[model samples]
Target: MLDIDEFTPGTGSYEWHLSGDRLLWSKGLLAVYGLTQAPDRGEGFFTSVHPEDRARIRQEMAEVCAKADRFEHRFRIVRPDGRLRFVLDRGVVVRDATGAAVKLSGVETDVTDVVDASTFPAGQGAAPAARGDGRMEEADVIDALFNDAPVGIGIWDRDLRFVKINPLLAEMNGLAPEVHIGKTPKELLPEVVDIDGVTSLLQEILNSGVAKRDVEISGCTPARPSERRFWKEHFFPIRSAGRVSGLAAIVEDVTEARKAQETIDALLHELNHRSKNLVSLILAISRQTARSRPDDFLPVFQSRLESMSAAQDLLVRRSWQDIELEALVRSQLPHFAELIGARIILRGAPDVVIPASAAQSLALAFHELTTNAVKYGALSNEAGKLTIAWQVSADGTGLQIVWRERGGPAVLPPSRKGFGSTLTGAMLQSTLSGEIEADYSSEGLTWSVKFPLNP
Candidate 1:
């Protein structure tokens, strides 16, 4: 066993022996002070300490010696090399037989690795944490969580001033985090009305002594060039000294979710309405098919009907939110591949995400295009190639997609519209609410669709 007076280095630790106004610092202490010598006054350990902390360290030393009482304090020391070092000073006070203060000893550990001084336990007389690391230590874990977290975080003070902000919340204001700190919601975040309103809500918590949790709030960020979307905000109160002090809010940018939900609800409503309306269309189609080919009850038509239902099933699976573009393309192209005796080449970014409603519409439109191509266009021949490529814009505003066909039958515009034409047109118009063009040339057919990105 080691004697209490004999300080041993464990992990990052140091021992300091205080006797009168002089200190005998261990090798570990010297290393932390960035000193060249152990217990050598000539090493200038005192000068290495940050000037502001020197007096407090001295005063605490005097009190420990005067009362012969155990004491602890934290202070910053400037390394002889000029780097600031944060250290915790803790030790016992020893006395003589007459009870006169003789020695004060303790250990100083460097805790600079941890981020966020507020998160660390600051002992009495512990120096206000060094200015270096702003984040609470263990930033890697936080970084991973920040990327995966569905909600946003914002740290604020009692005065409603922002202290720290997570990337998600920072992304909300279209501003970087550094620009937001020390700014009140109304001052820097005028774009965030919901956050500005949180000021009063936090005030209520402060005045009433009650913490607010999971309170639902909604508002829009400042208008961007395209569209303004809304978000649902959740405010959580941060407390200090057993009193409501500031706020730690988590914001969920639910604009897409809300829009998707609305689209689903609307689609469900339209599905019901169209289920009734389509009966007439189905009856007409059945009558027309029966009249045109009375003896031939073409069961192949049932397969087509099944295909439509399967498409609806896929849409329902995503709740009309979005679908995997590659999966959608691959799932719809196999039949056309066999018919045309060629392959549909899909070349683009892998796993590029798209909205649900857009997926449903794009899937249907592609299906119709492929069916028509197999029957009349490029896919009709084994020598043909159907290539599709997509790329997202730098601004993230929209995606650019190009579909080109080569070495196929000469293309010509349809003389009259058909089910495939009407279906493709309607689906693109509804889902993208943007742009579509099918250019027919002697070479082949080129189909393109531009879908709006924002909800």
Candidate 2:
């Protein structure tokens, strides 16, 4: 036999002898079951079970005795005073030398405070299946839904004390159900009650008997004292005998939901801003193209628009976060793919992400450079070559990009500024807050630009 004194103080222990239907209960067991005195060993034990659960307990006990196997059961026991308490009974059958069952010994725990409706037997606290009436008892249905609800639910008396709280509400407050009984919101959530005005709101609901819906509360709770959480709470006045008695509250955690909404709002704002900038840029490009190349205005305008569109496509793909420098270069230079490895060379600080605002201007500058090279510079002949290289500054404050062309024809400085020159020089400087320098040397056309990486 297990030593009753060795078990935890509040838990109950028991032993049952199958031969004579004898039973023994420890002192703790008597206290847990609210028994004033020990009953005749086996006579009164089954009588203490709730009437509805008695038959099932008897059948399960008989099966355990006959099979000589382990048994585990949970049921409600009616205390001497008529209160119903949930308990768990677990034991292993003891066998004799002949392998016949001799006794069963195990422990019992009063789980009334912790048990929820989901653990109740079918048709008791659980939802009823289709049957003769096809309707469940009102009290049972209320009990099932209240305890099994996903959101926090609680009832507070007119005095603002907790009259009843479901497990979900208790857990949200970082307390057990029993601890919440008779406690006010001020006592349970002192840290946040005032900041969120929870107690005042509940009081108002009680006084006015009016319902408050979707009241947002945000603050720290004992459950996570250091972390802030948000809840959307609905408060309704509870009425008894046609008079305001208390208040009932349903609370849903909306912390993540609110965060998601903020993210979407930010993205939408960004989209609107970028769309306006794109329109402004397209207008400027059309005006400049028309002024510079009037006879061929449409082709020039279309080419510039296509280059800007490619850059916008890249930004959209990245959620307008940042555009990779290598990706931008590759996208703007697709026309040179055939000569990329042999005659055209690209080298730069790898994996650099350019800011969105600077990406479009830089893409246009690259288009102008490539167009000039194909028309008059190095790329016009098979023997010509082009080299593009870039690097971040040693202090990491800025980036420098160099474009050099060679072997096509002797280079000469433009006698007058054209659209291509203006874009690569003045336009880039104004848009990117950068500096550009061009050298028309006998060897090649060399151009260099320095700009802040972040700006």
Q: Best candidate per lDDT, number?
A: 2
Candidate 1 off by > 4 Å: 1-304, 316-320, 336-342
lDDT of each: 0.62, 0.79
What is the TM-score of each predicted model, taking all chains together? 0.37, 0.70
| CA RMSD of each candidate after superposition | 17.0, 8.1
- Candidate 2 lDDT over residue span 1-455, tens digit each: 44764233335677888788787788878887888665666658978887777777777777887885666667778888888777766667899988788898876766554345455664242223345786766556787799899999987767776656777987888886655554578767877735547777778888898999999987778898998788999999877567786788999989899999999999899889888988988888888778878999988888888888899899889888877888998888887788877898889867877788898999999999888888888988889999998898999889889999999888888988878788899989998899999999977899999999877
Kindly list the per-residue Cα lDDT of model 1 for residues 1-455, writing each as its tens digit: 11232232311233333343455555555566666665444235557666766676677666777774656555666675777656655556677798877655455555343223443333322434334756644434555676467677876666666655676787877766545544567766454446656678877765775656656554444435345566666666665656565667777777788889998899889788757744654564456446544565475245335445555566677665566677677667655545432366788887777875465456656766776777787678778888878887888888867778888888888887655565567546665776778788889988777776775
Stretches of candidate 2 exceeding 4 Å from the true structure: 1-140, 191-196
Please give the lDDT score at residue 149 for candidate 2: 97
- How much is the lDDT of residue 428 in candidate 2? 92
The Cα RMSD of model 1 versus the native structure comes to 17.0
